[model samples]
Target: MNLALTVLNITAPVFLLAAVGFAWVKLGFEYRVEFVTRMAMTLSVPCLIFVALMRIEAEPEALAALSLAALSAYGIVMIACFALVKVMRLDVQTFLAPLIFGNTGNLGLPLALFAFGEVGLGYAVVVFAVMAMLSFTIGIWIVAGRGSLKRVIQEPLVAATLLGGVFLWQGWQTPEFLTNTIDLIGQMAIPLMLITLGVAVARLETKAMALAGFLSLIKVVICVGAAWLAATFFGLEPVAAAVLIVQVATPVAVTSYLLAEKYGADAQPVAGLVVASTLLSVIALPLILAFVI
Candidate 1:
């Protein structure tokens, strides 16, 4: 109940503001939605990442869980999702790359920053980094079904992850005063992203929304189930499992919809998936958190 209320309190204003803007545009503020997405992407989201990465502390033990699971567990799920995509001969739009790759940075990051705080998030970043890189290269290949390996290689998301890894490896924590500033900016990331998301959903048609909803269920169920079994086998502690589950269980990355739209890969369904998963995550989060943490 506390968690539910917290999500409501945080999400309501963000969503309502976006809905109003969307309605205003429909009422005919067309630029308002664009403004939100741009601001969030360029300014807010990056700040959120910088702040979270600088402060988010990964313990040796928690990091161990990540290292051990990389090849065995995470690898297995990635391979399985690919196999399903191949065996079922699904549409390019329904490929596992985009649906399964997830949105750990924008949506997942803020949620972790709030729900678990600094220490708990460290482990989550591990799973996050893997999918973060793959989302552009492998995920785009799955979704686009065209050769863009070079473009994918140069994706900004990929660059950010790589830079972040270097900084992490270099142990370059931010100065105290800068940390304060970054957190304040980072706090804005979600509201702006959510507002953008709500507007994006408002743009989608009914059929698209329905398709997205169906895919959203598949993504979450597959991810959470895989993460749980892996955590169990790895003998992950409650906290370790909790971190990983959140990494997998987060809603489709808001950017997934953007990518779909850009790549002509059924954008509306992806939008629907993002919106539905986010709404349902209210219920889903606590259930997963309890089992793990």
Candidate 2:
């Protein structure tokens, strides 16, 4: 009973903030997703990642273990998702990327923060960074048949991740004033991301929900299984293991829909995936948290 409430305490704010965005959109309020996303990605989120990585309280060895565990989990998930897509006779370009990459950024970051606090966020950032690199490189390649290394290099968040890792490795700290300013900027990341997630979902229009639902369930199972196996194999600490599972098992990101649209794949089905998987997450994340916690 206490555990249930604990899970609720952790997840409520996440969904509630998202709900605010959902309701705001439904009430005919104006929200410019493009501008908000650009600001968050370029400014707020990178700041958050840099600060989190720089100031993470976890041991270097533990952090390193989680990083490798996350990478292995994602690699295994890619293979599993590939086989599943082929077996289902799905459009590989449209379906494979969505299945492989989950919503590790907007959803995973906040959940890790709430469930396990700053240290969890630190671990989560590592996983998020891994996902970002893979998504831009291999994920884009899967959907577009030719990913651009130049495009990935242009992402500000990627630079932030690399710099942050360097800082963490060297036991470096920014000046107090600079750190405070960056911390202030970083503070916007979670709320903005959650709200943007809701807004994005509200705007998506789905098709083939039945297929979406089935695939969504399959994704959760595969992600949890793979992450758990990887964490155990790599002997990640408890918090690191939990964070990896949650991050990897997050639902299909709304970005998947945008990618499909851009690459000339069928966007409607991907939209269905985004919606179905997200709705599934409201229940799925908490249950997983309960077990992990």
Candidate 3:
């Protein structure tokens, strides 16, 4: 009973906030998704990553282990997803990226924060940062047929992650006033991302429900397995291991559909993925949390 309540307590706020956005859109409210996404990506999320890394209480070595574990897990997932796509004869451009990359930002971050507190948030940010770097570079390459290192370098989140690493490595702290200001900005990231996720799902149109649902199930299974392997191999501490598993097993990111639309690679299928996987997460994530937590 306590365990069930704990899982519910951790998960309910996340879905509730997303529900608010979903309801807002269903009621015909105007929520500019592009603007919110840009602000969150360019400003608030970067601040959140920087502050979390800068203020994290975990030792630098432990964070490093988690980083390597995250990278390994992503690599394993990519291979597994690619093989699945090839075997199923799905479009490499549309299916591979969505299957490999999950919604680490919108869903994973808040769950980690609620389930494991600040320390979990710290570990979650590490995985999110790793995933972001790959999504901007390799993920874009998969969808667009070309990768741009310059674009990756120009992303504010990447810069923040790098800078934050430096601060963490040197045991440096920003001035108190500056820290508070940045933390305030960082605070906007989670809600903005969650609401934006809901808004995007509401706006997306998808017809490939059966395929998307099957692939989403496969994705969760593969990702959970990969993350578990990586965490065990890297010897991640309990919280870090749990965070990695949850983050890696998160549902398809809404950005996958946006990327498909922008790159002209069958957006509808990707949209189906986003919607299907997200809806599945409503049930999947809480169960995963129950096991991990």
| lDDT for each candidate structure | 0.63, 0.95, 0.94
| Candidate 3: C-alpha lDDT | 0.94
Cα RMSD (angstroms) for every candidate in the order listed:
4.0, 0.8, 0.8
Task: State the lDDT at 255 in candidate 1.
Answer: 73
lDDT by residue (tens digit), candidate 2, 1-293: 99999999999999999999999999999999999999999999999999999999888888888889989999999999999998999999999999999999899999999999989999999999989989999998998999878978999889999999899989999999999999999999999999999999999988899999999999999999999999999999899999999999999999999999998988999999999999999999999999999
How well is each residue in 1-293 modelled by candidate 3, as lDDT tens digits? 99999999999999999998999999999999989999999999999989988988998889999999999999999999999999999899989999999999999999999999988998999999899889988999999999878888899988999998899889999999999999999999999999988888999889979999999999999999999999999999999999999999999998898899899999999999999999999999999999888
Clash pairs, model 3 backbone: none
Q: Residue 61's C-alpha lDDT in candidate 2?
A: 88
Any residue pairs clashing in model 2, and if so which? none
TM-score of every candidate? 0.75, 0.98, 0.98
Q: After the best TM-score superposition of candidate 3, give how far the Cα of residue 90 lies from its true spot, in angstroms.
A: 1.0
Query: In candidate 1, where is summed lDDT lowest over 10 consecutive residues?
Result: 9-18
Q: lDDT value for candidate 2?
A: 0.95
- Candidate 1: residue pairs that collide: 25-28
At residue 96, candidate 2 shows an lDDT of 93
Tell me the TM-score of model 1: 0.75
